[model samples]
Target: MSEKIYVPISPPTLLESDPRANLSDVERALYEEVLKHFSDSEYQIPGIEEKGRLTEAEKFWLSYECLLRYLRAVKWKSAAAAITRLESTLKWRREYGIEDIVSASHVEPEAVTGKQVLFGYDTRGRPALYLFPSRQNTDEPTRQIQMTVWMLERTIDLMGPGIETLALLINYGDKAGNPSLGVARTVLNILQDHYPERLGAALILNVPFLLNAFYKLINPFIDPVSREKMKFNPEPVKDGLFTGDMLMSEWWGGDQNFEYIHEKYWPALVGSCEARRASWLEKWRALGGKVGLKEWEYKDIDTPQVVDTKAADAKAVVDSEKISDVLTTESRVPTLAAA
Candidate 1:
């Protein structure tokens, strides 16, 4: 049986040049403007900047790419809004101990249930993250959330240049341990708000009848853009969007005999993470020193609206049956089955 390996590949040449080249004229201009704004010392996130852990070179690389990601997330419309969001994320990272997460060497034992794993890349070269909810071993909501975030961060770091997005394959094979609506909502909020434009596609596989009903109840809250990107059990391998040879035999109709072995996979992932970190540090040391955001600036923006859980639950109950019908109808959409 052939096995797939995950490692960081070289970034695209375009990124090596001016990262702005990847954007449109309008977007490029906005990216540059935002970059300049963040370069200023006055614009620093209070406690984060004060730490002074990041070297000058690291700051430059971070400011350049980070600002671009923020702009891309908001579609480059509002500079003030993007800045506000970026600053908020920096603050959140500080509170969340994201730095420690990246540096950690071992996978959380509870998180390694042979359920969620990073597979090969998609046709677009975006990494594919597979999740088997039925294999979930723990009901601790916080740990689940943490594992989700950890996987997301690792996937993001593994991204190659020109491939900022990712593909998610959620296998609801029995639908026995599906996360609750509240958990789903929290994950959605994190992705929509913090990781903008990061999801290229979400392919839900082996969805049971009951799970389809749940999808229906929760579908309304999902943004239209996100809804458009979602596919319910697509045949990418058959359609040639993905090569069957590259997929594990357990899923996607491939022939390769692949099974999740936690003991083996976890150590490989740790090594990959360490190597990637070293590569990033080397690159930062070489180029990070020359770049710096001299002065900082600040802007005022309103906080995002909070979700009403009570109203959401009531609505879900009211629309449960209706959602089944909606899913049945939507299943006929040609693109949904086409990868």
Candidate 2:
């Protein structure tokens, strides 16, 4: 009998030794393709105006953002996997010039890892808001604030006529002593008083003030051509609505120009969510919240009566033909005998 060989399992740690440990072959190939396209000499920041002078702290944070963006796109499985790819990806690593920083060396894992994302898509399956920003000014902090407002407005719209939800996302980076903050607080107070029947959940994402400078520096790399393509020129929904070809075309067109760093990898995740929506909704209702279809809410309501003038005209023409012979004794006797 041959001796059995035992494989050793690695212990969990904050740092991983190998950079390629996290990468699947396909993912590694995709990473290389993306970097090859984006890392050309033309992509370099030319001057201080486009890419501002970076301090040591700013350099560290920007590199962290870049690594997380790539890892997030890949959907890594574990902490070790996430860190390993973060170190090996030359596109991001070259910017920072170092590998993963152990959480223990800096701060506790809970401090950074425990923080939740600020705003998520709501229960109604619509985004809370559409953050449409002017291409002229592309500040990340500003864009984040705009997205926050969009989320709040969308929530209120979905909640129905009289109901409201209390929510706000503030960027503390903007004008520290500004009076607008007080105005925002007052508005929320008024809304809370108006919608006493519903529970309000407030979400706040407080990004560090250093982010203002970060966006300013990275503006040159923001892909201007893509932004131009994404501009919305509204058309009547009735023109091309619900055409399968149109939907797929629009999806494909938008996909080629720009990629949302956070949302690109969510389609597969959402497919799983769709599979579980029915059960998840039932569990949500069991927790004491109301669950009913939008159509159900309007069941008793009557739609406006529609009279077709052409149909009425056709009926009048048939009546004028005077078909009384069909109802006469001769026609009726023959019809009855055949029956």
lDDT of 1 by residue, 163-189 (tens): 567778888875555579999998888
Top TM-score model = 1
Deviation in Å, model 1, residue 287 alpha carbon = 1.3
Give the clash total for candidate 1. Answer: 13
For model 2, what is the C-alpha lDDT against the true structure? Answer: 0.27
Per residue, candidate 2 scores C-alpha lDDT tens digits across 39-71 of 343443223344433333223222222333444
User: What's model 1's lDDT at 20?
Assistant: 39
RMSD, one per candidate, in order: 14.1, 27.8
Q: Give the top-scoring candidate (lDDT).
A: 1
